[model samples]
Target: MARLTNSMFPSIPSFTDRFFGGNLMDWNNWNFAGIDSTLPAVNVKESDSDFKIEVAAPGLKKSDFKLNYDKGRLTISSEKSDEKSEKNGKEVTRREFSYQSFQRSFTIPDDIVNADKISAKYKDGILHVTLPKREEAKVKTVKEIKVS
Candidate 1:
Protein backbone atom coordinates (compact mmCIF):
# COMPACT_ATOMS: atom_id res chain seq x y z
CA MET A 1 0.00 0.00 0.00
CA ALA A 2 1.20 3.50 -0.76
CA ARG A 3 1.76 5.68 2.28
CA LEU A 4 -0.14 8.97 2.27
CA THR A 5 1.94 12.02 3.10
CA ASN A 6 -0.97 14.29 3.92
CA SER A 7 -4.08 13.13 5.67
CA MET A 8 -6.16 16.06 4.42
CA PHE A 9 -5.59 15.37 0.75
CA PRO A 10 -5.90 11.90 -0.75
CA SER A 11 -3.57 10.77 -3.50
CA ILE A 12 -4.91 11.10 -7.04
CA PRO A 13 -4.25 8.57 -9.77
CA SER A 14 -2.15 9.71 -12.68
CA PHE A 15 -3.77 10.20 -16.08
CA THR A 16 -1.80 7.31 -17.54
CA ASP A 17 -2.68 5.03 -14.66
CA ARG A 18 -6.36 5.88 -15.01
CA PHE A 19 -6.30 5.35 -18.77
CA PHE A 20 -4.49 2.01 -18.26
CA GLY A 21 -7.16 0.78 -15.85
CA GLY A 22 -5.05 0.98 -12.73
CA ASN A 23 -6.73 0.74 -9.35
CA LEU A 24 -7.10 4.22 -7.99
CA MET A 25 -8.04 3.02 -4.54
CA ASP A 26 -5.62 0.19 -4.12
CA TRP A 27 -5.14 1.07 -0.46
CA ASN A 28 -8.62 -0.18 0.30
CA ASN A 29 -7.76 -3.73 -0.70
CA TRP A 30 -7.72 -6.00 2.35
CA ASN A 31 -6.38 -9.49 1.73
CA PHE A 32 -5.85 -12.18 4.35
CA ALA A 33 -2.11 -11.52 4.53
CA GLY A 34 -2.67 -7.77 4.88
CA ILE A 35 -5.45 -7.90 7.42
CA ASP A 36 -3.33 -6.66 10.32
CA SER A 37 -1.41 -4.08 8.31
CA THR A 38 -3.74 -1.12 8.54
CA LEU A 39 -3.72 2.30 10.03
CA PRO A 40 -6.33 3.26 12.61
CA ALA A 41 -9.12 5.56 11.48
CA VAL A 42 -8.99 9.14 12.71
CA ASN A 43 -11.55 11.93 13.05
CA VAL A 44 -10.82 15.61 13.52
CA LYS A 45 -13.31 18.18 14.67
CA GLU A 46 -13.05 21.89 15.28
CA SER A 47 -15.25 23.92 17.57
CA ASP A 48 -15.32 27.56 18.54
CA SER A 49 -13.02 26.96 21.47
CA ASP A 50 -11.02 23.92 20.59
CA PHE A 51 -10.18 21.15 18.16
CA LYS A 52 -10.74 17.48 18.94
CA ILE A 53 -9.01 14.47 17.40
CA GLU A 54 -10.28 10.95 17.77
CA VAL A 55 -8.46 7.79 16.72
CA ALA A 56 -10.03 4.35 16.74
CA ALA A 57 -7.60 1.80 18.11
CA PRO A 58 -9.09 -1.12 19.94
CA GLY A 59 -7.30 -3.72 22.10
CA LEU A 60 -4.60 -1.26 23.09
CA LYS A 61 -3.57 0.22 26.41
CA LYS A 62 -2.77 3.84 27.23
CA SER A 63 0.92 3.02 27.56
CA ASP A 64 1.02 1.94 23.94
CA PHE A 65 0.50 5.48 22.66
CA LYS A 66 3.30 7.94 22.01
CA LEU A 67 2.33 11.56 21.30
CA ASN A 68 4.55 14.41 20.24
CA TYR A 69 3.89 18.05 19.40
CA ASP A 70 6.50 20.24 17.76
CA LYS A 71 6.75 22.96 15.11
CA GLY A 72 2.99 23.14 14.60
CA ARG A 73 2.64 19.42 14.12
CA LEU A 74 0.97 16.86 16.37
CA THR A 75 1.95 13.22 15.87
CA ILE A 76 0.54 10.07 17.41
CA SER A 77 2.16 6.68 17.10
CA SER A 78 2.36 3.31 18.82
CA GLU A 79 4.23 0.03 18.62
CA LYS A 80 3.45 -3.28 20.27
CA SER A 81 5.10 -6.68 20.28
CA ASP A 82 3.94 -10.06 21.44
CA GLU A 83 5.54 -13.46 21.65
CA LYS A 84 4.14 -16.90 22.37
CA SER A 85 5.83 -20.23 22.81
CA GLU A 86 4.72 -23.79 23.25
CA LYS A 87 6.86 -26.25 25.20
CA ASN A 88 6.87 -30.05 24.82
CA GLY A 89 8.90 -32.25 27.15
CA LYS A 90 11.10 -29.31 28.26
CA GLU A 91 11.77 -28.35 24.64
CA VAL A 92 10.25 -25.50 22.67
CA THR A 93 7.98 -26.90 20.03
CA ARG A 94 6.50 -23.77 18.54
CA ARG A 95 7.15 -20.04 18.81
CA GLU A 96 5.35 -17.08 17.35
CA PHE A 97 6.00 -13.36 17.45
CA SER A 98 4.24 -10.32 16.01
CA TYR A 99 4.85 -6.62 15.91
CA GLN A 100 2.48 -3.79 14.89
CA SER A 101 2.96 -0.06 14.60
CA PHE A 102 1.27 3.00 13.08
CA GLN A 103 1.67 6.73 13.05
CA ARG A 104 -0.61 9.71 12.26
CA SER A 105 0.19 13.39 12.13
CA PHE A 106 -1.74 16.65 11.76
CA THR A 107 -0.63 20.17 11.03
CA ILE A 108 -2.06 22.55 13.63
CA PRO A 109 -2.31 26.24 12.79
CA ASP A 110 -0.18 27.82 15.46
CA ASP A 111 -2.00 31.15 15.34
CA ILE A 112 -5.20 29.56 16.59
CA VAL A 113 -3.84 26.88 18.89
CA ASN A 114 -2.15 26.76 22.26
CA ALA A 115 0.23 23.83 21.89
CA ASP A 116 1.27 23.86 25.54
CA LYS A 117 -2.28 23.40 26.78
CA ILE A 118 -3.11 20.44 24.58
CA SER A 119 -4.36 17.32 26.36
CA ALA A 120 -5.33 13.77 25.46
CA LYS A 121 -7.25 10.81 26.82
CA TYR A 122 -8.03 7.26 25.81
CA LYS A 123 -11.43 5.69 26.41
CA ASP A 124 -13.49 2.95 24.82
CA GLY A 125 -10.89 2.28 22.12
CA ILE A 126 -10.86 5.96 21.12
CA LEU A 127 -8.00 8.39 21.63
CA HIS A 128 -9.21 11.94 22.04
CA VAL A 129 -6.99 14.99 21.84
CA THR A 130 -8.18 18.46 22.83
CA LEU A 131 -6.36 21.50 21.49
CA PRO A 132 -7.42 24.69 23.17
CA LYS A 133 -7.43 27.77 20.99
CA ARG A 134 -5.38 30.80 21.91
CA GLU A 135 -7.25 33.56 23.73
CA GLU A 136 -6.53 36.02 20.93
CA ALA A 137 -7.66 33.56 18.32
CA LYS A 138 -11.11 32.99 19.81
CA VAL A 139 -13.93 34.32 17.67
CA LYS A 140 -15.10 37.79 18.61
CA THR A 141 -18.01 39.92 17.53
CA VAL A 142 -17.14 42.75 15.13
CA LYS A 143 -17.78 46.26 16.42
CA GLU A 144 -19.13 48.81 13.99
CA ILE A 145 -17.49 52.25 14.01
CA LYS A 146 -19.73 55.35 13.85
CA VAL A 147 -18.96 57.90 11.15
CA SER A 148 -17.22 61.03 12.54
Candidate 2:
Protein backbone atom coordinates (compact mmCIF):
# COMPACT_ATOMS: atom_id res chain seq x y z
CA MET A 1 0.00 0.00 0.00
CA ALA A 2 1.28 3.48 -0.85
CA ARG A 3 1.65 6.00 1.97
CA LEU A 4 -0.85 8.80 1.52
CA THR A 5 -0.73 12.29 2.91
CA ASN A 6 -4.23 11.92 4.33
CA SER A 7 -4.28 9.42 7.12
CA MET A 8 -8.07 9.22 6.90
CA PHE A 9 -8.15 8.24 3.23
CA PRO A 10 -5.98 5.58 1.66
CA SER A 11 -7.93 4.89 -1.59
CA ILE A 12 -7.48 8.31 -3.24
CA PRO A 13 -4.34 9.23 -5.21
CA SER A 14 -2.42 12.47 -4.67
CA PHE A 15 -2.91 15.38 -7.08
CA THR A 16 0.50 15.08 -8.73
CA ASP A 17 0.16 11.32 -9.17
CA ARG A 18 -3.14 11.50 -11.12
CA PHE A 19 -2.02 14.54 -13.14
CA PHE A 20 1.20 13.08 -14.56
CA GLY A 21 -0.46 10.20 -16.39
CA GLY A 22 -2.59 7.79 -14.42
CA ASN A 23 -1.86 6.22 -11.08
CA LEU A 24 1.83 6.54 -10.13
CA MET A 25 1.78 2.82 -9.50
CA ASP A 26 1.02 2.10 -13.14
CA TRP A 27 4.31 2.80 -14.95
CA ASN A 28 3.11 1.28 -18.20
CA ASN A 29 0.41 3.91 -18.64
CA TRP A 30 2.75 6.84 -18.13
CA ASN A 31 2.76 9.68 -20.69
CA PHE A 32 6.39 9.15 -21.57
CA ALA A 33 7.77 5.63 -21.82
CA GLY A 34 10.81 3.98 -23.41
CA ILE A 35 12.29 7.33 -24.33
CA ASP A 36 15.49 7.02 -22.30
CA SER A 37 18.48 5.78 -24.24
CA THR A 38 21.97 7.17 -24.67
CA LEU A 39 24.11 4.21 -25.61
CA PRO A 40 24.55 3.20 -29.24
CA ALA A 41 23.54 -0.16 -30.67
CA VAL A 42 26.15 -2.86 -31.41
CA ASN A 43 26.27 -6.01 -33.50
CA VAL A 44 28.73 -8.90 -33.19
CA LYS A 45 29.41 -11.59 -35.74
CA GLU A 46 31.79 -14.55 -35.80
CA SER A 47 33.18 -16.56 -38.67
CA ASP A 48 35.87 -19.14 -39.37
CA SER A 49 38.59 -16.50 -39.39
CA ASP A 50 37.63 -13.65 -37.12
CA PHE A 51 34.94 -11.90 -35.11
CA LYS A 52 33.42 -8.66 -36.29
CA ILE A 53 31.79 -5.99 -34.15
CA GLU A 54 29.88 -3.01 -35.40
CA VAL A 55 28.73 -0.03 -33.36
CA ALA A 56 26.07 2.32 -34.69
CA ALA A 57 27.09 5.79 -33.68
CA PRO A 58 26.44 8.73 -35.92
CA GLY A 59 27.73 12.32 -35.67
CA LEU A 60 31.00 11.22 -34.14
CA LYS A 61 34.42 11.52 -35.71
CA LYS A 62 36.92 8.68 -35.93
CA SER A 63 39.25 10.50 -33.57
CA ASP A 64 36.58 10.40 -30.84
CA PHE A 65 36.88 6.65 -30.42
CA LYS A 66 39.29 4.94 -28.02
CA LEU A 67 39.95 1.20 -27.85
CA ASN A 68 41.99 -0.86 -25.44
CA TYR A 69 42.79 -4.55 -25.02
CA ASP A 70 44.08 -5.91 -21.74
CA LYS A 71 44.05 -9.29 -20.02
CA GLY A 72 41.45 -10.84 -22.31
CA ARG A 73 39.24 -7.77 -22.22
CA LEU A 74 38.48 -5.50 -25.12
CA THR A 75 37.14 -2.08 -24.15
CA ILE A 76 35.65 0.33 -26.65
CA SER A 77 35.01 3.85 -25.48
CA SER A 78 34.42 7.27 -26.97
CA GLU A 79 34.29 10.78 -25.65
CA LYS A 80 33.53 13.90 -27.66
CA SER A 81 33.13 17.51 -26.65
CA ASP A 82 32.77 20.64 -28.72
CA GLU A 83 32.17 24.33 -28.22
CA LYS A 84 30.77 26.84 -30.70
CA SER A 85 30.83 30.57 -30.27
CA GLU A 86 29.58 33.43 -32.41
CA LYS A 87 30.93 36.91 -31.78
CA ASN A 88 30.14 40.29 -33.32
CA GLY A 89 32.82 42.93 -33.25
CA LYS A 90 34.34 42.04 -29.88
CA GLU A 91 30.89 41.66 -28.33
CA VAL A 92 29.58 38.35 -27.00
CA THR A 93 26.79 36.97 -29.15
CA ARG A 94 25.94 33.28 -28.85
CA ARG A 95 27.81 30.27 -27.54
CA GLU A 96 26.95 26.66 -27.13
CA PHE A 97 28.80 23.61 -25.80
CA SER A 98 27.99 19.92 -25.76
CA TYR A 99 29.62 16.79 -24.39
CA GLN A 100 28.77 13.12 -24.95
CA SER A 101 30.51 9.89 -24.04
CA PHE A 102 29.94 6.14 -23.88
CA GLN A 103 31.91 2.97 -23.16
CA ARG A 104 31.41 -0.69 -24.11
CA SER A 105 33.52 -3.72 -23.20
CA PHE A 106 33.70 -7.32 -24.38
CA THR A 107 35.40 -10.35 -22.92
CA ILE A 108 37.70 -12.03 -25.44
CA PRO A 109 39.09 -15.52 -25.19
CA ASP A 110 42.82 -15.23 -24.79
CA ASP A 111 43.65 -18.67 -26.15
CA ILE A 112 41.69 -18.18 -29.39
CA VAL A 113 42.10 -14.53 -30.18
CA ASN A 114 45.10 -12.80 -31.79
CA ALA A 115 45.18 -9.69 -29.67
CA ASP A 116 48.06 -8.07 -31.45
CA LYS A 117 46.33 -8.27 -34.82
CA ILE A 118 43.03 -6.80 -33.67
CA SER A 119 42.07 -3.74 -35.66
CA ALA A 120 39.23 -1.26 -35.97
CA LYS A 121 37.98 1.34 -38.40
CA TYR A 122 35.15 3.85 -38.56
CA LYS A 123 33.16 4.12 -41.77
CA ASP A 124 29.99 6.07 -42.51
CA GLY A 125 28.16 5.88 -39.18
CA ILE A 126 29.48 2.56 -37.94
CA LEU A 127 32.58 1.53 -36.05
CA HIS A 128 33.90 -1.88 -36.94
CA VAL A 129 36.30 -3.90 -34.80
CA THR A 130 37.93 -7.04 -36.05
CA LEU A 131 39.22 -9.76 -33.75
CA PRO A 132 41.21 -12.31 -35.70
CA LYS A 133 41.22 -15.91 -34.55
CA ARG A 134 44.28 -18.05 -34.07
CA GLU A 135 45.09 -20.78 -36.57
CA GLU A 136 44.30 -23.54 -34.12
CA ALA A 137 41.00 -22.04 -33.12
CA LYS A 138 39.69 -21.48 -36.63
CA VAL A 139 37.17 -23.95 -38.03
CA LYS A 140 38.81 -26.57 -40.22
CA THR A 141 37.37 -28.20 -43.34
CA VAL A 142 36.09 -31.75 -42.89
CA LYS A 143 37.61 -34.59 -44.88
CA GLU A 144 35.54 -37.60 -46.02
CA ILE A 145 36.52 -40.88 -47.62
CA LYS A 146 34.22 -43.22 -49.53
CA VAL A 147 33.75 -46.70 -48.12
CA SER A 148 32.60 -49.80 -50.04
Candidate 3:
Protein backbone atom coordinates (compact mmCIF):
# COMPACT_ATOMS: atom_id res chain seq x y z
CA MET A 1 0.00 0.00 0.00
CA ALA A 2 1.18 3.53 -0.83
CA ARG A 3 0.38 6.66 1.20
CA LEU A 4 -0.58 9.98 -0.46
CA THR A 5 -0.07 13.43 0.98
CA ASN A 6 -1.89 16.68 0.16
CA SER A 7 -0.79 20.28 0.50
CA MET A 8 -2.79 22.61 2.68
CA PHE A 9 -2.48 25.40 0.11
CA PRO A 10 -3.73 24.98 -3.42
CA SER A 11 -1.26 24.86 -6.28
CA ILE A 12 -2.85 27.92 -7.84
CA PRO A 13 -1.72 31.31 -6.58
CA SER A 14 -4.00 33.05 -4.13
CA PHE A 15 -6.07 35.97 -5.38
CA THR A 16 -4.23 38.39 -3.08
CA ASP A 17 -0.82 37.08 -4.14
CA ARG A 18 -1.67 37.27 -7.84
CA PHE A 19 -2.69 40.90 -7.53
CA PHE A 20 -0.85 41.98 -4.41
CA GLY A 21 2.49 40.45 -3.51
CA GLY A 22 2.60 37.60 -1.03
CA ASN A 23 4.65 39.57 1.49
CA LEU A 24 2.10 42.37 1.54
CA MET A 25 -0.20 41.73 4.51
CA ASP A 26 -2.84 44.43 4.62
CA TRP A 27 -6.09 45.63 3.08
CA ASN A 28 -4.01 48.02 0.98
CA ASN A 29 -1.69 46.44 -1.57
CA TRP A 30 1.85 47.54 -0.74
CA ASN A 31 4.98 45.48 -1.31
CA PHE A 32 8.59 46.43 -0.64
CA ALA A 33 10.91 43.90 -2.15
CA GLY A 34 13.22 43.14 -5.13
CA ILE A 35 13.79 46.85 -5.69
CA ASP A 36 15.79 49.78 -4.46
CA SER A 37 13.64 50.07 -1.37
CA THR A 38 10.14 49.84 0.04
CA LEU A 39 7.22 51.61 -1.51
CA PRO A 40 6.12 55.01 -0.24
CA ALA A 41 3.49 55.30 2.48
CA VAL A 42 0.29 57.26 2.04
CA ASN A 43 -1.57 59.49 4.44
CA VAL A 44 -5.01 60.99 4.00
CA LYS A 45 -6.74 63.67 6.01
CA GLU A 46 -10.03 65.48 5.66
CA SER A 47 -11.27 68.80 6.93
CA ASP A 48 -14.40 70.85 6.62
CA SER A 49 -12.88 72.73 3.73
CA ASP A 50 -11.06 70.05 1.78
CA PHE A 51 -9.32 66.69 1.74
CA LYS A 52 -5.56 66.27 1.75
CA ILE A 53 -3.47 63.26 0.72
CA GLU A 54 0.24 62.65 0.78
CA VAL A 55 2.52 59.78 -0.33
CA ALA A 56 6.15 59.17 0.52
CA ALA A 57 7.93 57.84 -2.56
CA PRO A 58 11.64 58.03 -2.02
CA GLY A 59 14.19 57.96 -4.87
CA LEU A 60 11.40 58.73 -7.32
CA LYS A 61 11.11 61.80 -9.49
CA LYS A 62 7.92 63.70 -10.15
CA SER A 63 7.95 62.39 -13.70
CA ASP A 64 7.74 58.80 -12.43
CA PHE A 65 4.31 59.26 -10.91
CA LYS A 66 1.00 59.36 -12.80
CA LEU A 67 -2.24 60.70 -11.41
CA ASN A 68 -5.66 60.12 -12.92
CA TYR A 69 -9.14 61.13 -11.88
CA ASP A 70 -12.35 59.80 -13.38
CA LYS A 71 -15.92 59.32 -12.29
CA GLY A 72 -15.23 60.59 -8.80
CA ARG A 73 -12.17 58.38 -8.28
CA LEU A 74 -8.53 59.33 -8.03
CA THR A 75 -5.63 56.97 -8.75
CA ILE A 76 -1.92 57.36 -8.18
CA SER A 77 0.56 54.99 -9.75
CA SER A 78 4.28 54.52 -10.44
CA GLU A 79 6.58 51.92 -11.97
CA LYS A 80 10.31 51.47 -11.41
CA SER A 81 12.80 49.26 -13.16
CA ASP A 82 16.55 48.76 -13.42
CA GLU A 83 18.43 47.97 -16.58
CA LYS A 84 20.53 44.86 -16.97
CA SER A 85 24.30 45.22 -16.78
CA GLU A 86 26.32 44.60 -19.92
CA LYS A 87 29.88 44.86 -18.70
CA ASN A 88 31.32 42.45 -16.16
CA GLY A 89 32.78 44.14 -13.14
CA LYS A 90 34.78 42.41 -10.37
CA GLU A 91 32.97 39.12 -10.92
CA VAL A 92 29.55 40.61 -10.18
CA THR A 93 28.39 39.57 -6.72
CA ARG A 94 24.72 40.25 -6.03
CA ARG A 95 22.03 42.13 -7.92
CA GLU A 96 18.94 43.80 -6.48
CA PHE A 97 17.52 45.76 -9.38
CA SER A 98 14.09 44.44 -10.40
CA TYR A 99 10.72 45.62 -11.67
CA GLN A 100 8.45 47.06 -9.01
CA SER A 101 5.23 49.01 -9.23
CA PHE A 102 2.87 50.74 -6.83
CA GLN A 103 -0.71 51.75 -7.28
CA ARG A 104 -3.31 53.34 -5.02
CA SER A 105 -6.74 54.81 -5.52
CA PHE A 106 -9.22 56.83 -3.48
CA THR A 107 -12.82 57.76 -4.02
CA ILE A 108 -14.00 61.37 -4.05
CA PRO A 109 -16.66 62.14 -1.51
CA ASP A 110 -20.08 63.18 -2.78
CA ASP A 111 -19.84 66.41 -0.80
CA ILE A 112 -16.95 67.43 -3.01
CA VAL A 113 -17.06 68.46 -6.64
CA ASN A 114 -14.90 69.93 -9.41
CA ALA A 115 -12.24 67.24 -9.35
CA ASP A 116 -10.68 68.89 -12.38
CA LYS A 117 -9.68 71.75 -10.16
CA ILE A 118 -7.73 69.44 -7.89
CA SER A 119 -4.04 70.28 -7.50
CA ALA A 120 -1.02 68.12 -6.74
CA LYS A 121 2.59 68.70 -5.81
CA TYR A 122 5.61 66.41 -5.59
CA LYS A 123 8.74 67.40 -3.73
CA ASP A 124 11.32 65.75 -1.46
CA GLY A 125 9.87 62.27 -1.90
CA ILE A 126 6.42 63.51 -0.90
CA LEU A 127 3.34 63.78 -3.10
CA HIS A 128 0.54 66.03 -1.95
CA VAL A 129 -3.03 65.94 -3.24
CA THR A 130 -5.31 68.82 -2.41
CA LEU A 131 -9.04 68.49 -3.05
CA PRO A 132 -10.71 71.79 -2.50
CA LYS A 133 -14.39 71.84 -1.69
CA ARG A 134 -16.84 73.47 -4.06
CA GLU A 135 -18.61 76.70 -3.16
CA GLU A 136 -21.77 74.85 -2.24
CA ALA A 137 -19.80 72.37 -0.16
CA LYS A 138 -18.09 75.06 1.84
CA VAL A 139 -19.51 76.45 5.02
CA LYS A 140 -21.67 79.53 4.50
CA THR A 141 -21.86 82.71 6.55
CA VAL A 142 -25.11 84.41 5.51
CA LYS A 143 -25.97 87.96 6.43
CA GLU A 144 -29.49 89.51 6.30
CA ILE A 145 -29.61 92.78 4.38
CA LYS A 146 -31.40 95.68 6.13
CA VAL A 147 -34.57 96.81 4.35
CA SER A 148 -36.00 100.34 4.65
Taking the tens digit of each residue's C-alpha lDDT, what string does model 1 give over 58-90? 888999999998878999999999999999999
Which tens-of-lDDT digit does each residue in 1-148 have in candidate 2? 3432645665665554445434667865543312334477888999999999998888999999999988778899999889999999998799999988889899978888998899999999899999999999999999898898
Question: Estimated TM-score per prediction?
Answer: 0.72, 0.72, 0.62
Per-residue lDDT tens digits of candidate 3, residues 48-102?
Answer: 7788899988778888889998877889999979856544676755555777678
Clashes of each: 0, 0, 0
Error at 33, model 2, angstroms: 14
Please identify which of the two predictions, 1 or 2, would achieve the higher lDDT against the true structure.
2
TM-score of predicted structure 3: 0.62
lDDT value for model 1: 0.81
Against the true structure, candidate 2 has what lDDT? 0.82
Weakest lDDT window of 10 consecutive positions for candidate 3? 1-10
Error of 3 at 81 (Å): 1.0
